[model samples]
Target: MTGKEEPKEVRKYLQQSHDRIFENNKKWAEEMQKKNPAFFKDLSAGQSPEYLWIGCSDSRIPAEAITGLDPGEMFIHRNIANLVCNVDLNVMAVVNYAVRHLKVKHIVVCGHYGCGGVKAAMTPKDMGLLNPWLRNIRDVYRLHQAELDKITDEAKKYDRLVELNVYEQCRNIIKTAAVQQCWAENEYPVVHGWVFGFADGLLKDLKFDHEGQLKEIQKIYDLTKDA
Candidate 1:
């Protein structure tokens, strides 16, 4: 192969990853057997993850690793731009299960400042296959276009857009029928907006609380309302 040619060992790399995971799991099982046998056996039965994390599909930001949580701690749903759409069945199913069955107390929408997906959404170019996914981010821009357009600093504008996108996605999650139903019946679960900073590997909460700011949205599913 030429010096500039891309590596053609994608399958080999995948095999290597499988090997590593096997070794890791073996070591983990051995440690668990030695130290915490009962806990391991209980975990084997099933998972009871408490947090539902909706995050970008960036390789850098791993939900489990960032939070330093174990395997069955956080249920995750990842997309290109980390968008929460009402019509997305896959995400909806995860949310339904997490809230209804698992009873997850927190639903976190995590976005990163250096997100390629958000950057693509800010541009006018055709993203081809990613158009539909990024369209949601574009909508966030449209909703706050006046503010975004007035910001002369390009870097600052991009950062603000990323934060805004997270807040909007958090709002979108609360607007879901299942989440609203959860709110109607109980107050256990709460939606939160967070941003992961790639530079420092720190998570900053955007303070977008679904319960406090979006009470009017909950009225849509109020069962007590006269029909």
Candidate 2:
């Protein structure tokens, strides 16, 4: 087909998809209101979430659905491979806001097995814009190279990398000043690492030691001087 003709067809399909989303949203809103008359009112008033969820931006893994959380129950931040880096303004701002303002009691860094970002990072090639972002996962592999090298099965190796990525990201969050100061002052927002598996739809907690990891990280990245 000609370029103009193709765009017309694509636009029609996208319009249909967009309309379907709003239709479903309207129905969902009606359902919520029916369940609780004050649902929308309470939601509009404000959100004081108890948990901050950091997870991969995979469409298959809906953090709220997997964790059985309501909309206002968890503040969420998602990125490719679920990475947490000091240089990333977006995630950094999210962490700071959640810890400082929201006072979230728990912060979960969740990654999933069979993640496209992790798989792409594993492949040694130039992925253009993705190279820099995926490099974080490569760093995770490098950190656990000896342990990862022991696994002969490629699938197992990939799975291990995903879990390790979550763990490292949790450590990264711990290294943040907002988290450190908040923990020192309130002893909350404990960081947790979790991995979601496609098969059987279960989350595998890596049993992150919040206080222990905080102490380990504070040896270098301590910022709780006032607290």
Candidate 3:
């Protein structure tokens, strides 16, 4: 009954939870080996994924599982709300490497309808250090305020915001020099915006027009002209 000690049930649960991860890892490795004897050897060599996925760091949605992509098939970068900020070196670095080195054919920005990050941005409160990160979502709301304001239901409005956030992030990716220059020369790395619905466990394609959007963006943010 020490105040600092955890209960026996809690300790037992913690131990089992920690042990299960290794147990599952061993089982998964064995299964992979049984399917493909060279799976580990191939995985250890290098990765050449065809797709770059920027998605929300939500535990409920596993990108590869939903898309039926195996390991090394997709390069994934996850954050609170799947934002692609110009000043964020981390996401920018990933985009640069994915395009320049990996030469991924598709770049996807996927958000979800019931995202906690988007919901927090919708709320009028200070979230300490998260304010800057969530402000990107708020900016998305501001840009589409007219359309969002007209919606009568809050739930529908939230869903719309999530979709719009994904759209804006996709636009951000297209604005990058890595994507623009690569597309100009190679015509690959098509950008897409998708929203995942937890209710149905399905992804909804926003059908982002990569070529059309690029044409419009290059009118102002053109980086390939000099390249």
TM-scores, all models, native as reference: 0.87, 0.94, 0.95
The 10 consecutive residues of candidate 1 with the worst lDDT sum are 218-227
Give each model's whole-structure lDDT. Answer: 0.86, 0.91, 0.95
The better candidate by lDDT, 1 or 2, is: 2
Q: Candidate 1 at 9: error in angstroms?
A: 7.1
Q: Which candidate has the top score in TM-score?
A: 3
Summarize candidate 2's per-residue lDDT along 173-221 as a digit string, tens digits: 9998898888888888889998898997999889999999899989999
The C-alpha local distance difference test score for the whole of candidate 3 amounts to 0.95
**Model 2 CA RMSD to the hidden true structure, in angstroms:** 2.2
* CA RMSD per model (angstroms): 2.9, 2.2, 2.3
- Candidate 2 regions with alpha-carbon error over 4 angstroms: 1-8
Candidate 1 vs candidate 3, lDDT winner = 3
Give residue 154's lDDT in candidate 2 (0 to 100).
Answer: 100
Any residue pairs clashing in model 2, and if so which? none
Candidate with top lDDT is 3
